[model samples]
Target: MTLNAETMARFAQVYRDNRGAVYAYLYGRAPEHDLAEDLTSETFVRALRAFDAYVAGDRPIRAWLFTIARNLVTDEMKSARRRRQTPLPDMLDESRFVVAEPDPAELVSAGHARDSIRSSLARLGGDQARCLVLRFFEERSIGETSTVMRRSPGAIKALQHRGIDSLRALITTGAIAP
Candidate 1:
């Protein structure tokens, strides 16, 4: 499908508005920054290629973008699993796999509260977690979140409520300190 000037402009606007949220979502799910960056880039590239097929009124653009990102991550995981094989002794390099310690300054930069919140978020169920991320972290309105999540607004509200309740319980239990 050919993308006209108007469609290209709209696609650009959508990318600009949702890029950070997409990257954050990818980072949250992926184990490393470089992997997340690669996935995020692939997400946008696929989105651009499929732009002609997207129906604007069916769902919010942000939701469509996220669906693409989610699919890409799933594909990457599958590909990794398929490529996995037993390592031979000669190919092993213990010295090359050093784990880096977290920087003290970076830890200080991310306040305790933010860390706690992230911990709690990680424990939430998939739907609830997505709702919370879209509604709170990304600052999307309920209507917008519902569109992206492909849920009714009422369902989104319920998920948000349950997610918040779970977060509170976690914090109260010191699983995630306030």
Candidate 2:
């Protein structure tokens, strides 16, 4: 794949448009912000290198990029386990603390609602969580998600329905902290 001006321009456009969403998705899964940012950069770099070979077909570019992102996160999780590393909640970093910034606790509380959803989805396990993430966060349609997940549309629908039910139960039962 030639790194021509036109090609580079298109990739740049994609990066500008989707970087935030990609980072948000990664930040939710990756244990740390730095790791999330790094994974986000790697995602785009991988996407660019593979861009020439990428065929959109019925799936949008976002879904393809997310597939790459998901795989990277999975690899990172496995590597973490191999290293026997566990993520501690946000560590005390006095230097990075800024007065103007909202309190970390407050910010976390603000996201409590979102966190519960993610926590519950995670509790639902791998296939269901992946289906929900691709369907909801990446805004992929059922057909697109099926293509990305390599599942039948009917399977995707079943998974989605079951995931939603489990998530509702988790939240309603106070299984995940609000």
Candidate 3:
């Protein structure tokens, strides 16, 4: 589709507004910065290609961008799992390379905390977990999250409340660190 100058300007504005949220959403799911960056870029590329088909009043722009990011991350995860099924050659064994590792006990501890939170999040219902991530981690408002999840604002609020309660319970039970 040929994007007019005005259409291109609108796309640029949307990108500027939502880029950080998209990147954060991907990072929350992917963990690796480089992988998240790649996914975020791919998400925008796809969005740009399909921009002509996008209806302005159909949904919030933030929601549309996030949907794109979520789909890319899901696809990337599936691709990674498929790649894992193939075994590496014995000659390229990582154990053969005696690389000096840095002593970062503090960093390891922080990572453990993140892992614990992720594990706790996994135990929540899909809707609840997603609401929590978009609301808290990505710092999206209730209205914005509702649009992304395709739920009403009230439903999003309820999910966020339940998700927070569950996270607190997990922390209290030592499933995750405070």
Which candidate number has the best TM-score? Answer: 3
Q: Model 1 clash pairs?
A: none
After superposition, the stretches of candidate 1 with alpha carbons farther than 4 Å from their true spots are 1-4, 84-123, 126-130, 137-139, 146-162, 171-178
Please give the lDDT score at residue 53 for candidate 1: 83
**Residues 17-102 of candidate 2: C-alpha lDDT, one tens digit per residue:** 88877887888788777999999999998999999889989877887887899999999998888896666897688787765867
Q: After superposition, how far is residue 36 of candidate 2 from its true place, in Å?
A: 1.9
Reference-based lDDT, residue 140, model 2: 64
Worst 10 residues of 3 by lDDT: 169-178
Q: Per-residue CA lDDT of candidate 1, range 23-89, in tens?
A: 9888766766789999989999999998888888966687788899999989888888889657567
Instruction: Quote the positional error of residue 88 for candidate 3 in Å.
Output: 13
Residue pairs with backbone atoms closer than 3 Å in model 2 (clashes): none
Arrange candidates by lDDT, highest first: which order? 2, 3, 1
| Alpha-carbon local distance difference test for all models | 0.82, 0.83, 0.83
Which has the higher TM-score value, candidate number 2 or candidate number 3?
3
Error at 85, model 1, angstroms? 10
- Point out the higher-scoring one by lDDT: 1 or 3: 3
lDDT for residue 6 in candidate 3, whole number 0-100: 96
Ranking by TM-score: 3, 1, 2
